[model samples]
Target: MSPQPPASAAALRARAETAGLHLPGLILAAEQLAAQVSPGAHGLRRAGPGEDFWQYRPASAGDGMRAIDWRRSARSDQDFVRDREAQTAQTAAIWVSGGQGMAFSGASDRETKAERARLLALALAMLMLRGGERVGLLGQRARSGRLQAERLAEALVAAPAAQADFDAPDAGALRPRQRVVLIADFLARPDWLPGFLAQAAGLGTTGVILQLLDPDEESFPYHGAVLFRSQSGALRHESRDAGALRGAYLARLAERRDWLAAQAGAAGWRYVHASTGDLPADSLTELWQMMGR
Candidate 1:
């Protein structure tokens, strides 16, 4: 069996009780990372000698018993943590592409691409948030700095399965100096990537573009004649030329990968392309180390 998690990881089994669901170990493991960074929240809770201080407030009907402060209750007639004002954390925002394409899983038995994406996104988000960095989620419904992992997971499941048109983010919606992490498969047309990177570079912001893809995306593993369909169902193929087109198809894919890497180098962005088969924990930890974390 895996060794017992760090004591700080108590937040996980604890969070599930609040969410009224059995959240996965992935989230708990990510919470271990989150403990590194102090997350900011608005509420009534005890403030201790932690590097990051959080104020708690009177218990709302929804607060879990775990979040309650029995010590404060013993002192005051009211049950609560010290209700402090809401404060913003100095955290980087993580924008995960929620296009339908992420929902695909080529042949992974553990989970689908979308599932992996969720695991990665949530883990990263929690990790950053723990370090006192506010996490802003970008998708069809963008939200940030909220203790809503369970809600976010549900949203990921219901989100529309289409890559963004790869265009500019909304004007002023993205800050230039903030640390920004962009995670996506980036399988869509490549029209908007240049502008996106250019704008981010101009802001003097350093970040990573985590491109998550299946093995097949890198290697066209179609050995036999077969029908293929895009996530959008806009394209359908009945092909017998898998061998004939294999060469051209692979060449085009290489060019695209090279183009993406070249663009990142030009704009001073860290690029990490992760395969679904990769052990996400190790890959993500390596990424942080590469970032000089």
Candidate 2:
């Protein structure tokens, strides 16, 4: 069989626009998944400087006279200080890989890796927004509120696809003190990742890397004769006994994941592995809990 032709620039743009048409549905799915998990510490309930009253605690020796709430003290025998909820919002930036490789799916029943990544990214942003945290795409300005979530969904769906087989995180976009979430397959062995992590460390930016993969990629369930082509049709491989490759493939995959985990650890960042076939809510819940910490 002849190699497939690459998609024309116009065709790629049209495809991206078509993807935009599903933004509403995608956002709804993400919202539903996010709703499954409670916001927990992500919410603005921590005691700090804020307008909303959080709790009243007994006055301590260090408490200033003016800090005491006389009205609350009058209600109780002991002096009390009114504590307000923390209004400070942390900034979270999310990036979903747009590489053509992400468009691949092992089976018709499973979502494309890109779709799964986008869903998780958007859902995570929604949850963060609910907790009063500012959220945005990695290269965009982080903002808090319902509108920001909508914008994030649009951006995730409408972004142009990467021409390369593997897309690297844009480390140059790192902002100081920003928490980032990068969702990608990481199968291409991104040479730029080490540099990106170094840059993030320099900027004091901490984050988590959620490596999303198709179940087929993880299990290597090929058998007999098989023809493998990348989504971009830029790479091709034919095997008469594909099953013979399983052991080596699995070993390499494990090595890749180990490398990723090590790199993330060196940077004081978290690393998570997820398969597209798994329940998205399960992954979302894990991410939600991790982000809260």
TM-score of each: 0.63, 0.82
Least accurate stretch of 10 residues (summed lDDT) in model 2?
Answer: 39-48
lDDT measured at residue 168 in model 1 versus the true structure, 0 to 100: 30
Candidate 2 — which pairs collide? none
Candidate 1: where is the Cα deviation over 4 Å?
1-26, 32-89, 108-110, 139-158, 163-172
* RMSD (Å) per prediction: 17.0, 6.1
State residue 62's C-alpha deviation in candidate 2, in Å. Answer: 3.1
lDDT string, candidate 2, 199-244, tens digits: 9999988889999999999999999999999989999999999999
lDDT of 1 by residue, 173-227 (tens): 4565656667777776556777877777777765677777887776777866888
